[model samples]
Target: MFLGTGGMTPGHQLAERDDRKTAWAWYRGRAVRDLANGYTMKRVYR
Candidate 1:
């Protein structure tokens, strides 16, 4: 049902140019099982 529990956003600012590109690509992946409704879902981004 896509409970939209929790998720991560990968972003950066131009001021933070010192940051590495890999850092922006790293984000938390999430998924859950909902057998009662017979569906699998993942968190949604705002």
Candidate 2:
């Protein structure tokens, strides 16, 4: 799996093989992550 760097024009690419790939981006006052199912992971535990 591959990850992306966040910026004004961040880019990403990924290939999965039974892996939980995720990507995060800042929006409003929340930290959200992307999943393979096209769902935003809005839960932060850190």
Give the whole-model CA lDDT for all candidates, comma-separated.
0.35, 0.32
* TM-score per model over all chains: 0.18, 0.12
Single out the weakest 10-residue window by summed lDDT for candidate 1: 27-36
Model 2 lDDT per residue over 1-46, tens place: 2344454222332233212233222342153223522343344422
Best by TM-score: 1
lDDT of 1 by residue, 9-44 (tens): 122343344354445544211222234234423223
| lDDT score, candidate 2, position 18 | 17
After superposition, the stretches of candidate 1 with alpha carbons farther than 4 Å from their true spots are 1-19, 28-46
Count clashing residue pairs in model 2. Answer: 0
Which residue pairs come into collision in candidate 2? none
Report how far residue 26 has shifted in candidate 2, in Å.
4.9
- Report the C-alpha displacement of residue 19, candidate 1, in angstroms: 5.0
Regions more than 4 Å wrong, model 2:
1-22, 26-46
